[model samples]
Target: MKLKLVLVEPEGMINFGFILRLSKNFEVDELAVVRPKFQVDHEEVLRFAAQGKDYIEKVKVYESYEEALEGTKVCTSAKVSGTDTVRDFVLPWELKEYVGEPEVLSLVFGRESVGLTREELSKCDLLLHIPASKNYPVLNLSHAVAITLYEVWKQYRLERGNLPQKPSEKDLEVFMRVAGELAERFVGDEVKRERILIGVKRLISKASKSELRSLLYLLSRCSSFLKG
Candidate 1:
């Protein structure tokens, strides 16, 4: 699985440099920063980056979070644990299962102090939370990125380019598009409508190829019926 590490509105120069290093170490396809607070070329950023300092010039800076994550399935990180739609999330270890069919994955992370907001977290296609003790679950920004990348590497590297057959990307995109239309057609509440779309997208990500065929066919037929 190809990974892109995305940090939103980050403020720490140290975390910035460490993340650059992590991106290099983990082979992340891209390192994207949204509205960063520090100068990317600052001396402190270079100092902390160590061997990773070469990547300083390679960072992709964005003006907004939406612009940063344009064309990838967004798997967001959070620190909380709950059943609420906004906070409900998959564990980092289980992320390999969600990488299905899609080649590029954007792993979006929030700021150092407060993490992703409820609205931002809720809009994610797949939410991931690294489990920790009840007393203090929040991890430092770089550490959290480290753990998540390590887990992704641990699982995906074992595949050795021998992943199981799944629906083609074109087919998956059509399935998601139709499913989204159906959700918009039937679900009245805009927020609930989005949750339905997110839930369906997550299910599609986790489904086996055979299972996806059936689910896709069902959703397509439903959409056709509504269109008629």
Candidate 2:
């Protein structure tokens, strides 16, 4: 399970330095930043990084947030996902289950004062929110990173056994399209069609290889019958 930490427009010098140390401590494969607020080698950042200052040199800088998440399963963390009505979110500990066996896991953290924007959160594959007391659930930038990274490290670094392989993106898309077409042909209820589409997507992400192949074959036969 490869890991990458993505900081989106990080501003606080101390928080950035602390997160740098946490990246090293957790053995992150890459530390990417999107348009950082200060110079990567700023004195204040270096001073707080302490032994982890060397990791600064390893940071990959990017102009846009999407560029940093290419070829990886993108997970964005926030105190509260304001757009939850339209978007689904997961807890930090459940991340391993949510992803579809991605080659790299890219964990994105937003700015210090405000978390990820509604648009950013919508684009992510997974919206992660740490469980906290309702009384005051807010957490600091570095603290959120630490908690999320720790949970991820515990899940991936200490694996118990072999894991199932997820279907490729191409196959999943084809399967989903076919399923949607089938729904359109037989199901007239718009609400029911929407429900079926959502379930089909979840199935594609978690089904085993043989299972997915079987489903594709079945769907193909159904489509053929409809044509006949």
Candidate 3:
């Protein structure tokens, strides 16, 4: 499947450098970052990414995570083992069923200090965790990038299966709008309500358009039911 990789508030420039290399390694089409801690001109990242300088420049920068995930199916990477918020959260290999063939995808990596926040993880349709030794669960940011991308690319080469159907951009927008309306309706207070809306947007980012169409229809029926 066609995919892009995103890094959120990356603290290590060196990791960014190697991740850029990994992007090309996996044939990933885009790289998006959200408010990186270090400047792009910083030597640590730039020097290590000398070979991938051109690719690095092509990396899109966003003021926030939302901006980076706009119009993309965002997937979050986790360090924990067992399933949680998103069921069936598995290693990249198990995700083969979802990948092979072609679809727009975005894999997100969070900073080292505090992995992805609960708020950020809520936005993803799928959560992926690299299987690591229980003794030491944490993985270096760049290493995690290399391992996950490799598994994804390996799966792509082996299966090469087609998807049931791909969703259109228009379908996704309508679904988002419908979801937004539902969230605003459910959460009455304005401040807390906005947070709920953000969660909904994140949850749907990874859904296929066909999946979303079904969801939109369900949401419509729910709206009518509420009225009665």
- Best candidate according to TM-score: 1
- Provide the TM-score for each candidate, comma-separated: 0.66, 0.65, 0.62
Which candidate do you rate higher for TM-score, 2 or 3?
2
- Give the per-residue lDDT digits (tens) of candidate 3, residues 1-228: 457788899998888888877776667788888898888656777778767766776688889788788433445455554545543375677766754354667788888888888778878767787767778878899998888888877776434344545566777777777777777888789888788767766777777767778888999899878878
In candidate 2, position 149 carries an lDDT of 89
* Ranking 1 against 3 by TM-score, winner: 1
The lDDT for every candidate, in the order shown, is 0.79, 0.82, 0.74
Q: Please, what are the lDDT tens digits per residue for candidate 1 over residues 1-228?
A: 567788989999998889889888887888888889988879999899999999876788999787777445455554555757666678888776865646778888998877788777766788888877768877889998999888877876645345555777776788888887877777889999898888878778877677788888888887778778
Residue 227, model 2: lDDT of 93
Per-residue lDDT of 2 in model 2: 73
Tens-place lDDT per residue, model 2, 118-164, is 78876677777887888877788899889988998778785544456
Local error of candidate 2 at residue 144 (angstroms)? 0.4
